[model samples]
Target: MLRGIYISATGLKAGLKQLDTVANNIANINTVGYRADITVNSGFEEKILNYAGKEVGKLEYGVNPDINYLDLSSGKYVPTGRNLDFALVGNGFFVVETPAGLRYTRAGDFQVNRDGYLCLPNGSRVLGEKGPIKIDNEELYVEKDGRIYNKERSRYIDRLRVVEPVDPVALEKVGGNFFVTAANNVRPGNALVLQGYLEQSNVDPNREYPALLESLRYLQSNARGLKVQDELLSKAVNDLGKVR
Candidate 1:
């Protein structure tokens, strides 16, 4: 009876974790450059089985109930009319300078800062091959090759630094639509940049929202199952105590 209760409780807890991941995906569905997370389940086998004081025996264990977190996949890109808005046409990341240090992002939404510096909406300076590309005038041009040019001077300012980490999953997503890579990951040597476009979130809200709802329902059902098991256990314990 106690074992049954433990198993049901584990199920309920795992269901809740699945629901949490689904809810997070739904919440970020509309976020620019957001990647949706995937969850996987793993099973564990019983170490030993003691059946009603009989000899301990080994039985083929079924899939153990556990949730494994998968990496977020790349999302699709959408076009925006803004000139500074950018996106990656292929596999790569744009470098940005934040207070914490340099970071990467698929979000190309950018604007010229007060100091005539091209930067993300959050004021993180966009990095170029030479360094942060500073625009002195409104007539600025960025090429697919990551070159920054000025119309007034007709000169190339710098090439944007587009680094590709060896393992994308090794990067950490910081707030403001940027990613920080692990210490060992190599810095991307070259990355193509697209101007006048923005990468949209990969999450399909229409699909994820409903799935999240279903997970919620599953969690509730499991909770009810656990409660029922708990009640039965309580009654059994009470009855056993009363037996003289």
Candidate 2:
């Protein structure tokens, strides 16, 4: 009875974790450059039930949630018609300078800061090959190769710092559409920079809605199982233990 209860509890925990992940994905469906997370569950270790030194059966514990990984799939390109907006075509991430440190992101919804530096919505300065990009005027032109040129001044500015991490799976998400990684990164060979566009979130509502329903059903089933186990345990302790 106790083992059954433990199994039910584990199931409940796993279900809740799955629900949280799914809910987060749904919430970020409209976020720019957002990547959906995929969750995987694995069964716990199986133990052999022995009776008088003879194996009777094998008992497996409930499921456990494995590490969640980013989808890494490219999102659809959205044309914003804004010069500050940028999007990547092939691969790589735009580097940004945050107070914590340097971070990588695919979001290119940039704006000029009060200090004449190009920055993200959160004010994180966009890094260029030279350093933080300074936009003195509004006539910014970005080539497909990520070179920034001022059309009015007819002068070439710094190139955008786009990098692809050695191991993208090792990258961890920081808040505000940024990712941090310890792996070495290199310039991508085929990534194209498109001005006046942004990358939409990779999360698809059609897929996420069904996944949400499935997660809810799993959670409800686990809750019912937990309740049943609790009731059985109560009956065993109270009614069954009563003096006849």
Candidate 3:
């Protein structure tokens, strides 16, 4: 009876965690270049103690389990023909300058602020080889290689700094579609810019919605088990008390 209670408790915890992930995904359904997270579960390993060349003590599932792992997969690329928009054809990240320093993102929805400086939607300055790419004149163009040039000046000013980390898990997600690196280090990669295309959110609602429902069902089943256990315990206690 005790073991049954414990197993149900673990299931409930896991179900809740999975539900959280699903909720987060749904919340970001329309988020540009948003990637949904998936939870991976692993069962507890049993250990058996041996005494005098024979098994004496047996181990069972742990009282608590820790889950840590979020797989990063590329989301689908959507086309939005906006001059300031861009997207990674392959694996890469666009670098941005935040108050917390340098960060990265897959969102290419960029725009020029009032000061003629290119920036992300949240107003974070987009980093380039020559710092933030600022165009004095309104006339400007971004090359496929991420080079920002002026047709009037006939000069190449700066190049967007795109990077890809060896271990993507090292990156952390910040608000406003920004990602911060663990050590603030960036890996070398292509920084191609598309003048008239925006990247789409990578989350698949069809898949995530079903997963969310499944998690809810699992939680419900666990709750039922817990109720059953409570009733059984109550019955046992009542019988013991009727010792007259």
Best by lDDT, which number?
2
Q: Under the 3 Å rule for N, CA and C atoms, how many clashes does model 1 have?
A: 6
Q: Candidate 2, overall lDDT?
A: 0.85
Model 1 segments more than 4 A misplaced: 45-74, 189-191
The prediction achieving the highest TM-score against the true structure is 2
Each prediction's RMSD to truth? 4.7, 3.9, 3.9
**Poorest stretch of ten by lDDT in candidate 1:** 58-67
Report lDDT per candidate. 0.72, 0.85, 0.75
Better of 2 and 3 by lDDT: 2
Which 10 successive residues of model 2 have the least lDDT summed?
44-53
Candidates' TM-scores? 0.82, 0.90, 0.84
Spell out the clash pairs found in candidate 2: none
After superposition on all CA atoms, how large is the RMSD of candidate 2?
Answer: 3.9
Give the local distance difference test score of model 1.
0.72
